[model samples]
Target: MLDDITELNENTTFVEEAKTIDEEDLYPFPTSEDEPTTKRFLGMTPAQLFVISIEFFFMVLIFGVFFMIVTERMTIPF
Candidate 1:
């Protein structure tokens, strides 16, 4: 009477399910096989490098002006 229902073992059935899912590409991100990765300079992307450079330039300019004022080269009226 139990012949109608086939045996379903957790170990065997889980392995089969895992294999099928692995074969399917339901992932949202691209795999290494999809495209070649690009290299970064100083481990930063172009946009990041541009923003950091701009910040550095402003910091240098502000400090240079302050130094000139303290040395009496450039005067600021009180």
Candidate 2:
């Protein structure tokens, strides 16, 4: 009394046609499909913002290490 709810043994083959180079293609992108768009936030793109964030993070880290060394918080093991 079981219905045909299980489709685990179905054979579905996808046939793809061979693509040829077309002279009429305005932007013949063979490998990449991503298009760069002018999207910005606060006069900076997401990538730019990411770089700035990384730079600021490193700056804070360097300053923190410098502060620790200057304040003599940790002893030099030598």
Index of the highest-TM-score prediction = 1
- The regions of model 1 sitting more than 4 angstroms off are 1-37
| lDDT per residue as tens, model 1, 19-40 | 6665336676877777557867
Q: What lDDT does the true structure give each of the candidates?
A: 0.78, 0.64
How high is each candidate's TM-score?
A: 0.49, 0.45
Runs of candidate 2 with Cα error greater than 4 angstroms are 1-39, 76-78
lDDT of 1 at 31: 70
What value does the lDDT take at residue 32 in candidate 1?
Answer: 72
Tens digit per residue, CA lDDT, model 2, 1-78: 124446433443222211343444646664334544654577887889999999999999989988888899965679
Q: What CA root-mean-square deviation does each model show from the true structure?
A: 7.8, 12.1
Q: Global CA lDDT of candidate 1, please?
A: 0.78
Ten-residue region with minimum lDDT total, candidate 2: 12-21
Best lDDT goes to which candidate? 1
